[model samples]
Target: MFVRTENFRTFTKLYPIITTITAIHLVLWLIVQFSENFLHLTVGYNLLVFQGEYWRLFTPIFLHESITHLLFNSLSLVLFGPGLERLLGKVKFISMYLLGGIAANVATLLLAPVYYSHLGASGAIFALFGIYFYMVFFRPDMLNTANSQIVLVILAISLVMTFFTGNVNIYAHLFGFLAGTIMAPIFLGKGTYTRSLSQIFPNMRRSPSTAGKGQSIFWIVLIVLVALGALSRFM
Candidate 1:
């Protein structure tokens, strides 16, 4: 719903870091579906990590155990990631995502059971959601009261799910949320103005002038090609 209404047109216009991240997740999901060894190699907090493989700390964020898990995370990311990326720009947005998710994984390694195998983008998605929650109050202009209430409702539901659901990892969610809260002030800066996707691509349309129209078309094709190229890796 968020993707259909708020981001449909804009997704084509702007550099969608959120969508890119989601695509990466989906692509990896596809790989995991096709390969048996993929999951064993990439999952976080695994026995391999304890044995000296360190990259598992970050690789787990790219994995999901089931379609339901990926679906919920993808939805949350589609809702929250674009907004934050639009507000913070690509660099800071990505930084927050990596740092927040990694923080969650690190915390999980310390707090969760050694035998527990954690995977999926729930922590990262929650990290973005936590930043969204923080922005609701501190950057009210960007996230209005109505949107704020929606975020709260989603978070409340997630918290309830964490407590009630057997497979949910609350520790990852908690630490990710904390990481987001801690990083928001640093990456979000003091700006309150939220830039629309259209604003980022004001000259997206074909113009009457031949050169201008050509340039616009070139840009559109370039963006589409890049997106397709990135997507082709998983297929």
Candidate 2:
């Protein structure tokens, strides 16, 4: 489910919302790179938020502090988003994404000091993981055994990294995940199980032996990318 086989045009056609949001990520990051004022205005600054600049909560969902930050979160959204988008439909999917992000920002506002500020879509990305986590236990029919294992392993690694890594927004990741977990039942009630990835690329189905290899490769590549992203922060 994590593998992407779609070409750019097909992918955009299939998952317009994901494509558009990723485009927004890129565009906003470029704008922020050149314009310090825009970055300050949109970043999730607790002081400004507490003083009634309410939009920070929402705007920060689309902003990132660096190119590496943008690429990591956007790559995550691209990899994991389409399945849920297909399952939940456009409206509910976007709703869950936004709610997860906004919830994280709100948590940051309440818990962090006045000087604290953050920018990225990690909160929303973790929210997607939260939904997958809920599926692994409660809605097993929605994901195959391989996908379930992938979700659990990746989530475990991510949570560990969240605490260990520097310059990370712990509040956003934790609360966004919580919000998605709580919201999953509401969004997924009585929905029929559908493997959107297989439907999109039926020809890519693999035998059990090859499937295991594919999963192993996926884990390796994803871990390398995540490690690079973490290391980039220090560099």
Candidate 3:
């Protein structure tokens, strides 16, 4: 289910919400890269948020601290988001994504120091994992065994890295994941399931033999990339 068989054009058409969000990530990162002032104005500075700059909670979800930060989150969204987006529909999917990010920021505000600041979609990305986790355990029909294993293993790795990785917002990741898990039952209720991408685009679908190998490779590559990305913060 995590495998992406769609071409660039097909992917955008299939998952417009993910495409738009990733575009926002890129655009805002570019803006912040050139303008430190904009970053300060928009980043999730807890004190500023407490003083009534409420938009910081939502805006920082799209902001990134570095090129690696941007790519890691964006790649994660691209790889893992489509399945949930398909399952939840556009409106509900976007709502959950925003709420997860906001919840993480709220956790940051309440739990972290007042001077703390953070920017990135890791919290929101964890939210996606939380939903998948719910599926693996509670809604088994939603994901096959391979997809289920993928979610569980990746989530475990991410949670471990959350603590060990430097400059990470541990609260955001944990709380965002909790929020998604709590909200999953509501969003993933009966009748929410939709046609898989393979069903919709028969011509593009891979044979089982090819798909199995592709998914294995995809999973390994994603894990390696995520691990390397987390480790790269030190280098």
Candidate 4:
């Protein structure tokens, strides 16, 4: 006779923040595959963006134009997100992801040709890569292990792909990397979490507010979107 016991230990190591975010992206893509209307609503349309559907700034990061796009970005997020989350903690990590994607979308909408639609989470993944890139330089300990070497190789391949690929949003990737680098000093700072946030935006220090660092990100994102949307009109 033989007996087998189920194993749940592996699941214990999974990062909930990364898993949940990935699930949402995959689920949204599934819906778009089945529903054309959703596909239309999700893509970053410049006209609709300026028309006050400011959500397009953030949502486009969740929308993938093709299955290949979804798979590549989803895989990158799943692989890179957990390590970053552990490094920065969940709240700040998610903020970086959102800010990266939003910044990339803003750059694309404003700088790319008008009527040029953009979508996909490569921007967010690039943000993660940006943080990793910073680590490779400033935080040498982060790349002390063997895993980091693999990540560096992966990033190099991605950079090459971004330049050669036709439909890719190169601008989004570039801006996302920049955004991540900008936020890294805060997320990976030496001080306490609150102090780190204050470094990111000095204004946060002025208010006697109860809002956490992550909550402040929403307001920052909103203000940036509104300001950029208005600026897009003039440009």
Candidate 5:
């Protein structure tokens, strides 16, 4: 799961996309178990109507109760991460992973039972699907034109899979898709991949740019909103 400079360079030099994705899949698998155990040690998650443990929202993404389920998520994560990471780089890619997953948790809490424990990378992968589609079809000029139609076709097929498949976490996927879609227009262009976090945070003035001190405010607000949203399920 860990990557050293040599391994990164060697793999990135060969199968840059696939190799990076494989690494992410491995790491995520480990994190899922760790998250579940951590939650049990602290808050705990339920099988259904998931306890408003709040942490369950994030932890569930890490644990897959079954091997087949893990396999599907790993495959999808590996397939999705490389393409998106190669484009978004490590920061935005990581942001997409965490934010998309959080977005999924939000949707799951709102729509499903609070005790219904859920886990998988479907939300993040779906976000990648949305972002990839945007980079390809919505902004084809950003990349080579030959890949544009191909990417669009792939997006269509994946969207169809959600509708046809029975247990594909379609709700999480849709939520991730919407989040990624909303962010795409803000960052999409024919230049280096970049995102502006300051736009969302209202207090960054022209001077005193050490916004690091206030980063916690972001999480505070996010968690508060999530907490309030989760409460709606019980009422």
Candidate 6:
């Protein structure tokens, strides 16, 4: 499958932004061999989701089971990521990718049966799908050049494929998609990226202005916790 550049020019214009992030993740993936090996699904695999090894939730998105898995996922980055990056800008776009990925993996560890180990960019990709759905459904006017038809079509197919695909952790994808959908109103709102939470909340009636601040804090704490936990796992 391919998303044409002409149809998604807004996404194309910011291709380099997401490419840089993908490159950084590629490098990070190489640094941790264990991260590469652990983020997989099998008949039986044990993880420290609650006990620790929290980074396992994130590391798998950085690795690929095979070249084909990497190819399709990177293609998705080329296809959809640019548009999202354009919408969310360099910062939040990256945050969505990383956070969505982490959330999916962590949820798998916390919720899914231990007999299965989950991995892939599917959760993050679904995050994009869910977020776009929110924009088209709730804040269509704010989107620069969004196509409602395209959004609906993409979501419909994604859901159908989710049910049919055997290797994928559909549960994780659903959780990430739900998370992204709920969070979109905050990111899509006025001054989401440029302004602080305090500033946005006062003007905002529906969402707390501190929404942005809360997201920032969440990212910071998540990063620190993952970092410290991963370091201990390595030690």
**Cα lDDT, all candidates:** 0.71, 0.85, 0.86, 0.70, 0.57, 0.59
Give one digit per residue, the lDDT tens place, for model 2 in 16-114. 999999999999989998999999889999999889999999999999877678777888898889999988889999999999999999999999999
| Tens digit per residue, CA lDDT, model 4, 144-200 | 423444445556666766786567788998999888878887788632222222222
For lDDT, the strongest prediction is 3
Mind giving the per-residue lDDT tens digits that candidate 3 earns over 1-235? 7788899999999999999999999999899979999998999999999999999999999998788888888989999999989988999999999999999999999999999999999889888888987887777678875677667778888888888889999999999999999889889863345444343234544566655677777877797667667765864
Cα deviation of 10, candidate 6, in Å: 12
lDDT of 5 by residue, 1-235 (tens): 1112245476567445456555655665566556865435332234433534566566555555444555555555643456566566677777776677778778877876545555666686677767766665456445454334434544665676667665556778899877777666665554345323232233435354543434434335434433432332333
Candidate 2, TM-score vs. the true structure? Answer: 0.89
Regions of model 5 farther than 4 Å from truth: 1-9, 12-52, 189-235
- Cand. 3 Cα-lDDT: 0.86
Give the poorly placed runs of model 2, Cα more than 4 Å off.
Answer: 190-213
> Could you tell me which 10 consecutive residues in candidate 2 have the lowest summed lDDT?
194-203
> Which tens-of-lDDT digit does each residue in 12-119 have in candidate 1?
456477778888889998999999798888888656677887899899888876666666577667655666777788998888888888888888888887887888
What TM-score does structure 3 among the candidates reach?
A: 0.89
Per-residue lDDT, model 1, residue 46, is 50
Which ranges of candidate 3 are over 4 A from the true structure? 190-211
Give the worst 10-residue stretch by lDDT in candidate 4. 1-10
The true-versus-predicted C-alpha distance at residue 104 of model 6, in Å, is 1.4
Q: Which pairs clash in model 3? A: none
| Model 4 RMSD, rounded to 1 decimal | 15.5
